[model samples]
Target chain A: MDRILYGDNQFFAVNHISDAKSMEQSMKFKENDAIIATLDQAIEAGIDTFMCTTHDRIAFVCDAVRSNPEKYKDFKIYPCMPYAHKYANAVTELGIQGTIKQYVPGNFFGSMFKGGKALVSKDYLAIMELLVDAEMKMFEGVKTPVVFLQNVITDLLLGLGMDEILKGFHDYVREKYDVEPGFITMNLPKLAETLEGLGIENPIICASINSANFRMSGGKELYEETLRTKKIRVIAMQVLGGGAIPPKEALGYVCGLPNIESILFGASSKRNIDNTVSTIHEFDSK
Target chain B: MLRVALVGAGKMGLSHLSILGAHPNVEVVGVCDTSLIVMGALKKYTKFPCYKKFTKMLDQEKPDAVFVAVPTKLHYEMIKELLDRKIHVFAEKPFCLNPEQGSELARLAEEHNLVNQVGYHNKFIGTFKEVKRIIESGALGEIYHFTGEAYGPVVTKKKDSTWRSNPADGGGCLMDYASHVIDLLNHLISPVASAEGTLLKSIYSQHVDDAVYSLLKLESGETGVLSVNWSDDTYRKMSTSVSITGTEGKIISDASELKVFVKKEGALDGYTKGWNVKYVTQLTDQVDFYLRGEEYSAQIDYFVNAALKKGPNDINTFKSAARTDNAIALIKNNSKTKA
Candidate 1:
């Protein structure tokens, strides 16, 4: 189970619910580390998409990996590079591969870390413009994953036809540059199967792709098709299910999925990171 | 009020019937088509008398307005018969296979002072108003480029003889799909200063094209690209999206939804200071303008209104539809050379 973790208070939090903003700090501090620990604890777990909180934290994760390459050999790190200036050098220097989750909302913790330039909104028509500009500057010599963060499923619901959009963007970018950049979705209801069916063969960083609400319903054949489809790079989200379940139990549930590649964690403080590591250790022992 | 008789009791003929059926000022007493299947279907479906030959129908109905929804190759003969009868026409698109025929109908419409309209529904969609607003506002910065793309699953499932799929019947992607874009560009920009259009039969490899891509240069120094294709995969795709970037702001719409993104500046001096995103919902407005605040209906009401009011033709006239005819001509000409 090449499990990937996803929790992006530090990545691209939509601030969809009002309570999300209220619990912003504690959730960011606690749940975020739980994600990392979940990764470290599970023998099957790996890190596919990581949103670096600070330069120091990113360096710390890099250092931790560099120090114990064998210990984390199966783990592939994909650090978030949201901006062209600040994180660009850090990500390029550290040689992190994955997405540059462009946080649209200003209030998200990682938004400021986006270095004041790259935070783009869904309303902006010229999204490709920013991507092209970023590629020209920081990504000139780099060949790494650059994923876009789409916060809400509302636009996906309303007009954009989220599955079609994911496919279209993938097709457009791949055709233009022959590069495989990606986008991430979290907790979108009634879309897991559709998202899974779309022919996107890229890495998806999520928490709970197989939750009860967004479960793989229909017959066994349909369920298997949903699990094995090509376009869907399932990044299971809400693994902790809003911190309701024990982190270890959540890790086990996510790791059971045969197709899941990574789970994202939002670690705000060092204690959170340590807790995440402990959780991962516990998962590994299990 | 202009007495209208709609020929070809098919999908398009029924659409016109519904509109004329509702308009109190317009009387649609006659309908004609070769398809007894459709005619029989319409006997119960419509309240109009159906006939086979248009000449006998024309003689009997003596309609002042006739809408031709027959096959493409037959459009010229049917429209010419109506023009000879001094009847105003509302012809379905591909005004007639090539520009020469389109030019002929346009001249006749002009000569008879008849209000002729063609079926190009996108021009009547609600988003064009927003497009026009954005263009006039000069918000999208210096408008250097505009592109429109419309596509759907290629109708490979259809039999080989579907008029929409046969070159003799004006079947192909360029004439069927890209023609909308060409007419729209001509409507929005200046009459397409110069254009280079290409049609590809790569995806389906049938006698007809599965895709068409056209590059155009407008007189305004703006370059435009239009894509028309039958995207044959699992997903069905049909869209007409427009993007215009000007000196100050941008206007982009898929017609399904219209949005204009503008750049705002400094607040009141010593009073306020901030910037904000402005969301302009222009789709509803466009619908109101296009349908004259009535529900989205056929262009015949407007045409009849224009005729009765002796006003401008709200529907696409033979002149406007001729642009598509010209573009189709270019695509066919290019396809032959490439072959």
Candidate 2:
């Protein structure tokens, strides 16, 4: 994992801190070319991995990366799966049956699985595979070395105690895509314990890690304790506490922590990207 | 542990189940749904008992509280059954097909001295809660006009048959999407006393309107515009927000963030005049189990805690949500008359 990873929240108008800033980002990155230009700047700023959600626009990004293979040779994308809206919108337009038929295909539609509830764990695993395939369709030719399960599903599975589904994702991604399966969640301590329980060792987990507890469930102390003790590759995001912390203070606190393999952040500008990269470098050097 | 049973194991049902399943004070005893396959999976996966019928699940489990996440139409009967059983209940939003049903359910719950709530999850959003606190604090004095909006890509295409395509099933931008915004306006600003100049436009779904626009008059003489559309594909997900203007300041807020511009800097704590902004992460208190957002679990937490109380419920209770339902009916009637 790269010590520094760039993110796509800014491209999609997802500023956890400010709506005004989000709108500004939306206007600035309204075009696919604009998005590509920002990525180029991230590359110049020395960020090789782009951690992004599978928003429909990410397809255009994938196409752009594919067309200019030489320019993006060293670049990689960490795809967060289920792109929930894809299924949400589909279910909105076509309901459950139609969504499964359109997305799941094959046995899911043809078998005695007409009743959505009738489909058992076997079908669920198949559906998970198919949906993962569908979500990964956007990254066809790009290099996605680590695929992530979005926190929504990760936390849901965690809450439901669906350990097998978590492992199912781990196994499917490792076996099928030949990539490491990562899980992003708000509750790092709980997930760490759960993964430990599942016998899934040293998992890759990206969560909110900052001086403030922020989105980290349990609390900041627990996250720090987990980081110190857990066997996991931790990609720290929301280190700024949704911009609550100053850049220097945020980076300083996170950089001082152990086992933080990468720090993920999103920026829609060259200046901000460069500043963030330089700040992280300064803290790491210290 | 508070014994809890769930009805309607659809998306929202399952979501609530997961969070409640993990709640420290809660034990999910049974889950009921019409979907055999959903039941089959629940039986196979989780330790909770699964049933196809709601009555049987409630009768067998004898839960202290029942979470009814069924469609809007099913809300009335199922919730009434729970209230009749003297069980504290939580139902999903856009409470019922009409205000009449909502009021009846509210009356039943009140008469039985039960804690009841509707899942207007936005009320638990810290940013929006801050908006309410700011407005009520008179930081934004003499609030005049506002606009409530929600636009998403839910019904971008013309559909064959779905819950979203049927008005009876609480399909439509107004019911499914706009209700969240309407409820926010009701709770944050004022209960909409009436509505006028309504325009329910169908951009995609033939059976139901995909967009709802209208002028709403709140009980406190505050006025606002309701603009909602589910056919807008620009947003990756449902985006709901409110922009309220007052003589002293103006506040614009969504699920993720809140922005306020005030004439005086010292008007509110943690907020400077001129301009101040806050995020969900900063404002929201952390929950033990967070699903999509803390608001989802927080809403359920509120309901579950309120369930243990003896008297009437508070915070998105049946009575409070009935106001939103009444507002929805006003908008619907106004739109129909003009159309």
Choose the strongest candidate by DockQ: 2
How does the DockQ of candidate 1 come out?
0.01
Chain B TM-score of every predicted model: 0.86, 0.97
Residue-by-residue lDDT tens digits, candidate 1, A14-111: 22111233235435434434544544643333344443322223444555556676775544443333332233322222211112233222333253
**Tens digits of lDDT, candidate 2, A61-168:** 899889988988998999998777677667656656667778874565675654433666887888789989988987998999999999988988888777888999
Return the lDDT, model 2, position B63: 95
- Against the reference, the lDDT scores of all candidates come to 0.54, 0.86
TM-score of chain A of 2: 0.94
Which candidate has the highest lDDT of all? 2
- Sliding window of 10 residues with minimal summed lDDT for model 1 chain A: A90-99
* lDDT string, candidate 1, B38-101, tens digits: 4543454345677877888888889988888776788998898888888888887767888889
How large a fraction of the reference contact set does each model reproduce?
Answer: 0.00, 0.66
Best TM-score goes to which candidate? 2
Clashes of each: 39, 5
